[model samples]
Target: MKAMTYRGPYKLRVDSKPDPVIEHPNDAIVRVELAAICGSDLHLYHGMMPDTRIGHTFGHEFVGTVVEIGGSVQSLAVGDRVLVPFNIYCGSCFFCARGLYSNCHNVNPNATAIGGIYGYSHSTGGYDGGQAEFVRVPFADVGPTVIPDDITDEDALLLTDAFSTGYFGAQIADIEEGDTAVVFGAGPVGLAAARSCWLMGAGRVIVVDHLDYRLRKAEDFAYAETVNFGQVGDIVRDLKFLTDGLGADVAIDAVGAEADGHVLQHVTSAKLKLQGGSPVALNWAIDSVRKGGTVSVMGAYGPMFSAVKFGDAMNKGLTLRMNQAPVKRQWSRLFDHIRAGYVKPSDLITHRFPLDEIAEAYHVFSAKLDDIIKPVIVPAS
Candidate 1:
């Protein structure tokens, strides 16, 4: 098998690797069909996450066919098409029982964090990811959702992460049917958040980002009313104006360190040479929300901490909800939307490459080359 491996800071290589097998009775082996590059993958490529072994695969968003399943995996079988959840959760864990699978104790084993994520660091449970020809899916029954024939893999793949994260962001923001929602960042996740907000029946969805291309795409996709931060000097003021002088009912921060509110911490390991987030965008989300509004932070973050204006948040009686998407928890509902054609996330994908060309895919998508938004890697059988 050929897998994308993390080489060094700003480096990646396609290398031959041993094929994976089911290691647990509840596990399954998946032949990856369409694996897409995610913004989170940038963390590993740039060496921002630690504890990722030198040769670990580097992707989490993918759809695949089940090649084999363990005896205990009765819910899934060979030849089943499935969307893999980024979060690995043990079904019997205390958190899983409470529908908080991302915080499953047995799988995550981190006091500070609740979920074990694919292709992340040891702190994230060190699971080998799906950016290769094959991947071993542990706790398969609790993770993957079978995709119906009516939905294409490209449309269903995002149920694994991006769309789910966006839905999670909306959930945390407490976005109600007539509420106005604002999303900071028009990247894939940001756009997804906007789309999800609309799907949730938001009265108005406003997407803010500095990139015109992304904002244009967001508008085309009906994700929201696009706001170009670069063109408008006062982004916060513009958001307020869009919301009729009252801040948005809910504001989601999807721009991590790239925005303003992050404390840049330099951490060194085999992977994740450095990682951080944006305090400015986070503060803007906080400031752009109504007095009784909710703010959801779902973009990727690192060990770096940001100074938060707790006094302001408290004075306004704002609610703050933040976390990586509980991918496992949201998979079912997302698949429902995909199956119903209510959400076609495939429109976000603009580039494709072979497994060996994974590095190039990263370069193109990371640089947003040629207006590329999402790039999917199709490993040859």
Candidate 2:
């Protein structure tokens, strides 16, 4: 099997590796047909996440065919085409029973925070991801969903993570009808969130980012207003001005540790590793929303202390909601939306690469070159 392996910061390559086998009774081995390089994967590529060992494969969004299944995996069988959510969890766990699949207590050593995530760093769970020809899926019954014949492979691939997380971000926002919703970052997740906000009854949606290309996607793909933070003097102030001085009704931080607005914060956190993740976008969310509004965080951040504006959030009576998205929880609604033609997840896929060219794909995505909004990896059979 050929898998994308992480060597060090800014280093990645597709290398031949041993194929994964079923290790647990509930495990299943999937022959990956399509995989995606998520924005969060960049954290590992750039050495932002802790304990991302060398040779670790970094991918979470994928759809594939089941080549082998364990005895206990009764929900699926060989030859089933499935979209595996990023979360790896036991169905009957304390958190899983409450629909908090991302925080399942029975999966990761650090299950106290986030559950097992495919191909994330050791902090989440040291499981190999599907950035290869094959991947072993644990708790297969609870996570992998058969891809409907009506849905395209690329759409199903997006549903595995980016679209699901984006929907979850909007779901947690509790957006009221006619409320103005503002999303930070214009990556796939942000674009999805912005699009989902409209479905959730938001009167207006605005996407904020520093890149013209992504901001353009936000406008075209999500039908939302765009703001380039780099062009503005103060992003929070600009957001407030756009919202007519009171500020937006809701603000979401889709940009996590690698946010670029604050120089000192980005340097200390992203460059120097002094903090968990740069909280610039989160802090901006706090400042950009109106008093008593909601701030939802869907961005991926390391498990270290970040200098967040807790005091200000408390003072303003803001509702701060954040978590690793329970991906499966959003599937039902997303499926309906996709079927209704309200959103096309595949439209955001801007590039595709063969597994052999994964390094170049990573470079293009990490460098933000070629207008690559989302890049998919196709493993040769």
Candidate 1 per-residue lDDT over residues 171-277, each given as its tens digit: 77777889999898787888888888877779988888767788898898755788777677678788888878989999998877641112232111012222264
TM-score of every candidate relative to the true structure: 0.92, 0.95
Q: Would you give me the overall lDDT of model 1?
A: 0.79
Stretches of model 1 off by over 4 angstroms after superposition: 259-275
User: Which runs in model 2 stand beyond 4 Å of their true positions?
Assistant: 259-276, 303-306
How many pairs collide in each candidate, listed in order? 17, 0
Worst 10 residues of 1 by lDDT: 260-269
C-alpha root-mean-square deviation, each candidate: 4.1, 2.5
Against the reference, the lDDT scores of all candidates come to: 0.79, 0.89
